[model samples]
Target: MRVTLYLRCRGIAPGTVDLVSTGLKTDHRGILVFTLPDNHPETLRLGTNDLTALNPEGRVPILLLPDGRKMTQSGPIIDLIESTLAPDDDITLLPTDPWIRAEVQRIMWIIAADTQPYQNIPFIIQAMGEWGMVKDNPTRHPLRLHFIRREFGAIENLLTRCAGKFAVGDSVTLADCFLVPQIRNALLAEIDLPSEFPILSTVWNNLLDVPAIRAVLDDAGGIVQPLVYDAEQFEVYNG
Candidate 1:
């Protein structure tokens, strides 16, 4: 059975991938696509709210797992992060230089896990701040976005060193996947996109062409269009 994950990015902020692009089941039975909210309650899942109660065993076809305790999409992305970068002992793949591969993995780490906090938390706060939707003392709305930007700002500088075609290393890696969506939001959050973030923005631009990511954005119909870049033109990378 093909399973679809519904993600709500309406309130997503700048510089981070949040309820937008984090779904990762990778099941072959069905293709993943975003559905409209008006079409909601009709899809497999109502919203992309990260309900781990769907699958407990951490199995494939994550949305329809009928047994065990459910694990959220978090587990799948984490496992992918580790496996995709880990060195392979099976010599069948590449007999190339180990040092180069190791360096590749190192850069992937910088883009994927290292850059996450900056993209997500800050983006959310910034979005909330923009609409003045943030609440008072019960929540530290005063400091959320400011604190997050400090982190993303650091990442923009780090990109100056490791960037080329992507945020880290010459080739695209997990970092690119982790980054593109966040960049979309960052732009939306109106985060200053000056030359200081050239490298980071470059990586975000490159990711606009990935078929999987593109498919998700393209399939998302109506209202959600404003949430993604070039939803007006179906383009993720403006450059």
Candidate 2:
């Protein structure tokens, strides 16, 4: 069954990249479907806070299956993809080895829960706005950079122990899927790539060699590949 992915053009929702990349590596059937970026005037008119059962949280990174079921949120969607879509073979994005699997989950938690939430564009926008700041405010951008830097620093230390060619091993795993898009976001925020964290840079560069990962990056027009992004269309909402 072919799946349809609803993802934003920016790397703001790194989980979408993780889900799509995992599906690709496991040979799970799927297709790309871009969502209207959150900043669109029409999206604003729809009311940012109004989320439905089909789109709980009013978020992207939704996966629609051929059977008409919609999958929302990054973590649950990733879990679904791994358990249901991945073949019971060597190429699975989730590590089969028990210890390695645990390590992968550890890295994933750091990225998904610790790192992503702080800098999530919508969440930051909402939270900052509540405090009397608005989108494009000078203070909001610095606040995002602060959390991103701290999270990346923690990941850098963790990578020193678990990383090989990738975050958990020589192969691309869920951890890499989570980390790559975060790194891309960091790049757009002017977080000096490769220079700040050499190990992560190596892993990010290596992972892009995978066709599935590359294709998603191209489709999303993430920071790493500026050529794929439309100049006028993609505005960095978070920064």
Candidate 3:
């Protein structure tokens, strides 16, 4: 049976398509980008294309068969990614190289959690929405830039600590893909790409050269926020 994956290319629901795309990249993911980049010019494919009725939170799972019957098994994405791991990839209580893996995990935690918690971002946005209001007289408050800049600064420090071409280990892992998007988002929030955080600038400039990211972009669909971000606003936001 073919696997169907739901992906959002943008925001905190922040689907770092890299992890998911690993399937497609390695012919592991049976799914395809719904819209080709040329046709759909949005960076993050942020929409409700895939909504399964038997969600994990529901306790009862629903599994949809090719024949069209629904049996409950709502953990499809995890199943899909797990299926893609190589022969060496195994689930263990501890890795053979515990120290190395621990460091890697630490970096991953910061990047995944502290760097940009895409998962909990909605709550932040929801809170911001409640805390502030938008009206015709003033669409947004200038202070928002400062709030975002602080966030970007945190990421910059993380990136700077790992300031090599990519994030985390010498090889690309879960961290690089995320750091890349967070930097891109910082730009979208009008955070300066360079001056505000030179370390981030150095790391980011280096990330631009990574082949995996470039390859991912080639396959990525829609208009990316990074591709259209404004420089001054980016500076003000990151600055």
- Top TM-score model: 2
Q: 1-239, model 1: which lDDT tens digit per residue?
A: 01121111111123222222334321121222223223333233545433233344322334322333333454254343234344544311121457544544454454445544444432333354355545432112334345435556776776667667755555544444445544544554556555546566666566555454555556644112233211222111111
| Stronger candidate by TM-score (1 vs 2) | 2
List, residue by residue over 1-239, the lDDT tens digit for candidate 3. Answer: 01121122111133322322211111111112222122221213333222222233322223333444444332343244434444343322113476655654565455445544432332233333345533111112234454446656765676556545545434544444445555555665556666798876776666556654554444443113323223233333222
Clash pairs (backbone) in predicted model 1:
14-185, 14-186, 15-119, 15-186, 16-119, 16-182, 55-70, 55-71, 56-69, 56-70
Kindly give the stretch of ten consecutive residues in candidate 2 with the minimal lDDT sum: 22-31
User: Which pairs clash (backbone N, Cα, C closer than 3 Å) in model 2?
Assistant: none
- Which stretches of candidate 2 lie above 4 Å from their native place? 1-53, 65-69, 133-140, 225-239
lDDT of 2 at 62: 65
User: Is candidate 2 or 3 superior in lDDT?
Assistant: 2
What does the lDDT come to for candidate 2? 0.60
TM-score of each model, in listed order: 0.46, 0.67, 0.48
Candidate 2 lDDT over 1-239, as tens digits, reads 01121122112235433343211110111112234445544335565423343375544666666566778767677677555533546566667789889998888788778877787554455554456554553223777788888888888888899999888778777787778777877776678768888888888888778666676677666545232123222233223
Error of 3 at 108 (Å): 3.3
Tell me how far the alpha carbon of residue 156 in candidate 3 is from the true structure, in angstroms, after superposition.
Answer: 3.4
